[model samples]
Target: MNVVKRQIDLKRMFTCTTFADRVRFLIELAVTAPSTHNSQPWRFVITQESCRLWFEPKKQLKEADPSSRDLFISLGCVLENFVVAAQYYGMYKEVRLHMKENFVAEVFLYDRAAAHQEEYRSLCESILKRYNARGLFERTNIHEATLKRIEDIAQKYTEQGVRLQVVQNSTDIKNVAELTAKGIRIARSKPLFRKEFAQWFRTNLSKKQDGIPGYAVGLPLLPSFIAPFLMRYCSLAKVLVRKNTESILTAPAVCVIESDTDSPETWLQVGRLAERVMLECYAHDLATSIYVAAIEMDNMSQELAQTLELRGRPQFLFTCGVPLTNHRKFTPRLSVDLVLK
Candidate 1:
């Protein structure tokens, strides 16, 4: 089946008049949020007036994400997208975080009359347009005004203890690129890591609902078919390191999302902040690519913290710029019915 067919038609979402139907529409947008390897590690239980978001442990990447950091962050992205969609439709009442339970959050909705803000509308619209740009980025630096707007967005999250740090200096960018290369080498050197990653690496013709499809990484048909097996058995550390390093170096800047603590709550907050920042960038006609290797490896997070001289622990890393190509490709998402509990 064509993976693009998995995306819901937004026109149908607009036709949803009932509270439950609107909530369902918002959930559809929520699932489009990016996750590690497109794992979509989340579930939802919906009621007439509310929806609860849960962390689906069965979808977790055990070997690649031993700390469950990426899992919680992925949940945060879903929460942000849901909230954005709610605001766009004016169905959002409030949300409560349940850090102590497997269910991460509960969002309450109402049919109260409201006007949609331009910002929320733009963010919601970008939900479908946004994709993790995986190829090389153009050499142009992000305009100062665009950078300032993104910084302002980050400032609003300070009360939640999350900060977005942008690194544009060539020296600093190279430093991060080197650390990320080292981290990739360390990760792919382990047989288990490769095996786990291979499971989620899908070929272009795959029918699976969740996972990173080969085209997203510029893989052709034959290579995509062979990539999983190659990753599972062979050490591609050197090749991967070179490719990733080059991609990072070519970008004009790197962004690091940091939090005051390293707990699940902080991770969720970082994810929300990261998704918002990414959407804001997309609204300004820019693309983003996420890189977690540096933050996922041992001691590397601390080294990254010191290198960037950040006041808090770094939880997420990504780079944004004008991509080399305008053609966008998306990873497949499971249907809302399939994810409902």
Candidate 2:
């Protein structure tokens, strides 16, 4: 019944006939797209004929994501939602990237309406509930059937060609753990990485959401320890190196998503595929944490790909497991005003 209500509301927003109504609705949904550190580095240029999204390069994570790798990943996340939301609202939508000095996408939506499908509606519904779960997962092994479902999601729209290697074996898990530890260690050695992490660390004990919130790490006293020591040492790099290594080296399983061409479009597809996988897992009470820290370091990425026997350049390192039955806590999100332009 809730799904039905949401669909009806979405349909009304789409079929309002007023240009302002449609643009407003798209803007509302687009901003909810996931971003690194909730930096929200996107701007929308809306029109009756088309809606374009621009990456606000200034809002980007300059130190950690110097090349805007994760920025594009976040953009891909919102772009997928735009496409899905448009379809759910019975609009025929097409997206094309317009690369100028900065990358922006011109999304063309046909004024005419169509019928929304059950699958499209489902994707739209999942958007609100989707978030990263970084807690220590349950010991239960994922069923083969569930793993196959994830594969199906990965295989869909795969013509754009992203490779998702799901690692379940003990040996494979250990291999990725080693690579993750290595990547985390290397990243810690860089002063820039520590600085970036420090900037995103929130010390506010009162707020429940955003800024790698304490709940995501399941550590209540983290901010106290992190705030003082993160920037104090000349070798802040060494301190981060140990902490990061510890987190990745013990994770249950790691999944690597890669692509033949590491372009913007392909990365966006990876986001869509990942959201699908995450939502599908949510339905079955599973959880995942994305450890980009491990994959961003070149050496760690190469080792992870080799361990997974992947065919393309790796783009994301996703560590997933079933959450302990009582460990689930939905992360807070910024309200509509927080996301919408």
Candidate 3:
């Protein structure tokens, strides 16, 4: 029902009979971009000439992301969607990135819609179809051609310091899984961390527009409500460590996206590269689930870089393979009116 409402609202907003402004149309796609814990920490100020994207810093998961790296990364995903939607719609956007508090970027729009829709149609379609696959991925390995295609997409980023490293062999996967397990154990043991993380789990559909829903993660409605309490009081070190380790170990492959420097701008670039690859995954008929433990914990993220000899800061790691299911409901998004500044 929530998904239907969102899709209906989008149809109404973008119909040709409506105003059909590029900024508004692009925003409809922008909000679909994923964020850590589904925080959706973004607001937009739409003017006649431009749409300014501001970061909502309070939405930052301080416990899970103390450096706020993931916050800007999430904003980057929004920005990436904005850019893609703009190009797809035949509009040229001028973006200015400002890595400060609640002030990310201002995107000036050009009225001319895409002259050649055919050129952008592939990724354009991917925008609507792309989703994060969180369930167990199929045991099959991804085809080499698809992997290279996605790598090509990441390579196209060409921005300074950002690079994508793909891990496929069993040995490397095992090493990463072990490090991630350690991080999970340490992260779950901290009361403050679990407490902060718990606030984002929404069991009731009507309750919140953002946050990871219980059903989305395969948890029943009632038990999910108690997750916060358990995270704070109970020791989840064993369960999380076990589950996270097994998932990584059994997955066919993992992707590590990293940057040479650990700065807001670099992380933002990481977001763009990450989204491009994620969208490309959909284009290749594959699935991706972000595994942040290797990058969320400072020590583990550092160790991961060393393990891969990346010579950079690791920002994200995730499983990639054939999806077990494709019937994923779109996560809810706050209304456009609510996010407008």
Query: Which numbered prediction scores highest in lDDT against the true structure?
Result: 1
C-alpha RMSD of each candidate structure in angstroms: 2.7, 4.5, 3.0
Across residues 30-123, which tens digit of lDDT does each residue of candidate 2 receive?
5555667767677777677877777776777876777677888777777777777777766646888885656568788877545666766666
- Name every residue pair that clashes in candidate 3: 89-114, 90-113, 90-114
Give per-residue CA lDDT, model 3, range 1-341, as digits (tens).
01111253323323443223546777878888889889988999977777888987678787898888888888888888888778766665578887666688888877555354566666656677666666666778888898888888888775657888899889999999888887887888788888887778677554788887767766676877777677678877887777677767777888888776888888888888888887777766676778788778757777888888887778887787776665447678887777787
Instruction: Name model 2 segments beyond 4 Å from true.
Output: 1-19, 110-116, 205-210, 221-253, 325-341
Q: Is candidate 1 or candidate 3 better by lDDT?
A: 1
TM-score of each: 0.95, 0.80, 0.91
lDDT assessment of candidate 1: 0.85
Ten-residue stretch with the least lDDT total in model 3? 1-10
Superior by lDDT: candidate 2 or candidate 3: 3
Candidates, ranked, TM-score? 1, 3, 2
Candidate 1 per-residue C-alpha lDDT over 64-173 given as tens digits, one digit per residue, 9 for 90 to 100: 88989999999999999998888876778899999766889999987642566565877877787778876688889999999999999899989988999999999988
Compared with the true structure, all predictions reach lDDT values of 0.85, 0.65, 0.76
Model 3 quality (TM-score)? 0.91
Error of 2 at 260 (Å): 1.9
Off by over 4 Å in 1: 1-9, 112-116
